[model samples]
Target: MNDQPILLILMIAVGLYTFNLWREDCKNAQAGKPSPSALPGATPASAKACIIAALGALVILIAETWGELRLGLSDQQSKITVLFGIYTLIAAFIEELIFRGFIVIENKGRALRWAGVAMASVLFAALHPFLWKWEDGVFAWTFSAKGWFSTAAVFASSLWFYTVRFASFNPHRSLLPCIVAHATKNMGVILIKGAQGFVVGLF
Candidate 1:
């Protein structure tokens, strides 16, 4: 089954949503009520923070890739395309906005913030559909150890993303570092997929 069309449509929708988020941020900034904890933060992104967050995510990704390989799970084999790669990059920002920005409850204390991160991470991991898949209008449940491992990794990555946002390095709680970290993890996946000859074409 070719899912290219569906992917394209979803990408367009997601792009629009991202644009809207940016616009809202702009408006907030102009109103002198900048949402430092949200998208389009008023403060400039720190290059050092970007590097630290990206490296942190990259480390997690490497471990996940290794585990998948050891488990003989080639999930991306013959499944990726250039279009998908592009979508992944766009989706990285979108996901970060949703999971790390909007979903997170702000102005909370340290414990509450970490609790929110934990809850968001769980939801993020569950949304990845590793233990189940919807196909042909039917939702099927099929569990694999590899799938579980991947889900766990995603959960861990989400924690890292939230940590990056709340960490002292991101004093203003800017989303830039989170975005970079997410992108690094996603691009790493694309690179690994391509290296394994899983990326077929542009689609």
Candidate 2:
């Protein structure tokens, strides 16, 4: 079975859902209670949080890239096209909305929240195809030491995303920082892949 159709449908679904959430957030802001959602909050603190989170992502990505080079690990990334790159960018936001926005347990104690973060991070890392692959509608499992290193890096980044969402720097628990951090990492991956000649054509 072709995967493009499935990916297209999934992308549309996520786009619609994210748009609805933004609409709801707009209404909430008008009502003076935005709650914890994916809205990029309007405040200096929000901007600062995004910058800090993005810098942290840069650090992690740099280290991961260096490690991959040192280990002589080939880039397992799929070929990049304009459409694929766009989808990946949107995915950065949608993933944060789901993993960092929906999976969070606000108003619960710190222990429970951290527990949820850990579980979400594991699930996040596992879904990235480092330990498994799905192609032509067939699923297969594969792993390597280098793949484990990459997966672990993903897990660590997820933890940082969660941290920026709930850290004291972001008192409103805004998802902006999480989105920024995720986008930074994804863009870094794309650039690295392009530099390494994994990118095919832009379109």
Candidate 2 lDDT by residue in tens digits, 1-203: 12364675578578768756765785676577765743554222457788999999999999998888888775555566655666777788788878887788878899999999999999999998778887777899888887798899999999999998888998877776888898998899888888888766645
Candidate 1 residue lDDT tens string, 44-118: 457999999999999999888887888887663337677778787778888887787788877778788788889
Q: Each candidate: what lDDT?
A: 0.80, 0.79
Q: Kindly give the number of clashing pairs for every candidate.
A: 0, 0
Candidate 2 achieves a global lDDT of 0.79
lDDT of 1: 0.80
Give candidate 1 misplaced runs (Cα > 4 Å). 9-42, 75-78
Positional deviation of residue 191's Cα in model 2 after best superposition, in angstroms: 1.2
Residue 80 of model 1 has an lDDT of 64
For model 2, name the residue pairs that clash: none
